[model samples]
Target: MDDFDALSAMAERCFPGLETWNRDQIESQLKVFPEGQICIEIDGKLAASSSSLIMEYDAGLEWHNWKAISDSGYIRNHKPKGDTLYGIEMMVDPEFRGMKLSRRMYDARKDLCRRKNLSQIIIGGRIPGYHKHADKMSAREYIDSVLEKHNYDPVLTAQLSNGFIVRGLTPNYLPADGESCGYATYSAWTNLEYVAGAKRRFHHVIEPIRICVVQYQLRTIRKFEEFHQQCEFFMDTASDYKCDFVLFPELFTTQLLSLPSVDASRPGQAARQLAAFTPQYLDIFTEMAVKYNINVIGGSQFVVENDTLYNVAYLFRRDGSIGKQYKIHITPSERKWWGVSPGKKVEVFDTDCGPIAIQICYDIEFPELTRIATQKGAQIVFVPFNTDTRHGYLRVRYCAQARCIENHLYVAISGCTGNLPFVENSDIHYAQSGIFTPADAEFARDAIADECNPNVETLIIHDLDFEQLRRHRDQGSVQNWNDRKTDMYRVVYQEDEKTFEV
Candidate 1:
């Protein structure tokens, strides 16, 4: 990567002791060892590539290593299995930039998912170490904006746009000065099949709950002004679809309102500027909620008070009152910078559609969080995330689907559209948003168009079928969410006796 020389020069502009390791270094550390790497070539050209790793760390980022894409959201409730994981590093080579390579990459990932059909896919994306310069938002937000438009979610203009779900961001996960590590958001899609040997009796008057998963084909919002415009558009679109509640990605407002031009020399001024911008967007979230008469999950942001930035996910009610969830799990930089405060109670509120619970990005990664949400009588869970690398985002997406199927609940996740910055080897974008419902055989095959896709906006709303959920829980035939062996779960989760053969 001679271009790395260019990156080296720019890096010199920032911190010391940071050097752009030569190709030899990358080869020695990655290519030779190939712990986590995948390449996709279409017609004699590199289309997409991915890589990742696993490590024991409290926070996730390593500044130079791959960010750990762990399934969050479990507040002492999600009992995760073993530490086995697959980290992915990807790039939709310049030749295949906007050609829906994400789906291809995902398909490749799924093939691997099947081969390694252990549990779930975990992508610890831009945890700093893997891609150091992931957060370089130039004063020209348009530069980053350009990135989003090219690969960014661009509103609702992509079919696979439903491929990604936004889980809220990690506290202080997004810092200024071209450096930050965030949690991966999740959106899982599996084939839905009608029960072959099924039984239904008293279903006469009431119809099955109809669900429509829609991903609007829209453009990316590069500026703060565009945020509200897109918001109104989606609100109206959802209304037209007669959907119950609408979803907005985590920190959706913050990304547009963000002022990335703080003087690196003066950290205080930068923090203050970001904080003011955050509040303005918060107000917008309230106004949008009231105007739309819908439930909008305000994305997480830096709520600065007394020099502290808290990672918070705000839920704006139809009445316009805001309910907040502060991210308790803080990455290292978060601890060093703002000292993100712990979140409040995560109780699902009663919405017109059904009972819902909201958790920010990292929160969803923890299976425990979703389990608790399901336990709390929540039929649906809304996760807002600021996903970074492709690997990190998909990890949670697959996990989300598993949770939904496991507990017979609905999970709606909205994540970043690649408007933010990230490390190298990450051509990550949420051009694909997602929705997973009652499994059907047809879905495994015909659900998503088996064709090369471009920018598309469609919804994944389908029938929730409370009757089906009841059946899934009761009928051993499907047993989708009914038969979890808690005893087996403890075998992996419980502490093992340390035996020493002295």
Candidate 2:
């Protein structure tokens, strides 16, 4: 409404004779409810505009035309506490039409619906391509043709892809709507995230993200079925608690070496034996993540790809997509006893909560690796570790704590607890899973959010507030990210593509 002139002009250009709003009409609507008026300006010029009003939804309501719903184009009958958002009009500059500005406007409308806790968004969408086939088919037949892929209507097709369902049709809705041929499709999109009794509310609180760490107990498995059930039990427990991400400890798959036929005497032989199950291992975790709709860091599994053994962590997304991050640094035992090769690259996975990086065991001890990951926009670092002694466990634990403080983000550590007496390389294990945070007043003073009792097989669940971490980074006692002396010293990866200037 503030840029009514620009919005009107753009609408006129986009739709020459198709019911463009004038100053008085726009002013009156804005006066009634200014919350529904939105305009986007790109480069000091108005590129798009969306106008809306609110109304109660009737389950058995008849199809409504634009004039009837808008109260003869004035929208004076808008209900302030309506449960549904009634889209009045949308306009985009001709120059920005093909740039997906309509989709952006639709996204904004859906967001507004959720913000207002509206039940759904209802709109009479114009079927612009109906006129071409008007003589042979009815409005309902035309919509069916478009749905069956026999014909297409640009407006209706785009709306359907944006989650709008065609409820009914109104013929001769707007007689002057030239492109639509006086026909409009009744479309509505329901907000599935809405709660039944929830009222319209606003909050700046970034939702608390919950994380679960699996203190996997090492034991011999007679069959892969047993391993699959064990994995599912942990994931189901975490998902029941509504944890966003579930993590497993490093080398947890080594328990498969306990099978009777596998030669588990030598470390190299055991790695090869585990590598044989890599395909089944991946399928199990990937399916688990998809079935449960949770992000899974399936620990570090040994893989023999192209005849080279590489220790890698697989991240499975809730959408059934998978990503792998290799251990960038290797230890002496890994190379000497297992013939393992180090990965030269690090990777990060993106989730709805935030971006995360997986640094396996020894790799977490290297501060530069975590630093690089944070520079690449990672908000959390997950360390899947395995240690045979308390000393080795402390090395990973202390370094992970330091990384969280230095990077100003959250860190989750998962490690194996029990010992595998029969398997050679997995003979002994000792660990405690813990979620770490920056050492700030707002966080746990000890930097440990939650931890399992030492040498116990358990699951540690903790809630991490990324918003609080962000606030700490912005105004905490010491801001490491902002206060870094990059001008004096910069750590650059040798194989990094970008050059660092210091």
Q: Write the per-residue lDDT of candidate 1 for residues 277-382, one digit (tens) a residue.
A: 6776777767766544456666566677666677677777755567776775555544554345655445667665566787776677777666666766787777
Each candidate's number of clashing pairs is: 100, 0
lDDT of 2 by residue, 457-482 (tens): 89988888988988888888888877
After superposing candidate 2, which stretches have Cα over 4 Å from the reference? 1-81, 84-203, 496-502
Each model's RMSD to truth, in Å? 26.5, 13.4
Worst 10 residues of 1 by lDDT: 70-79
Winning candidate number (lDDT): 2
**Residue 256 lDDT, candidate 1, scale 0-100:** 36
lDDT score, candidate 2, position 213? 96
| Predicted structure 2: clash tally | 0
TM-score of each: 0.47, 0.64
Best by TM-score: 2
lDDT of 2: 0.85
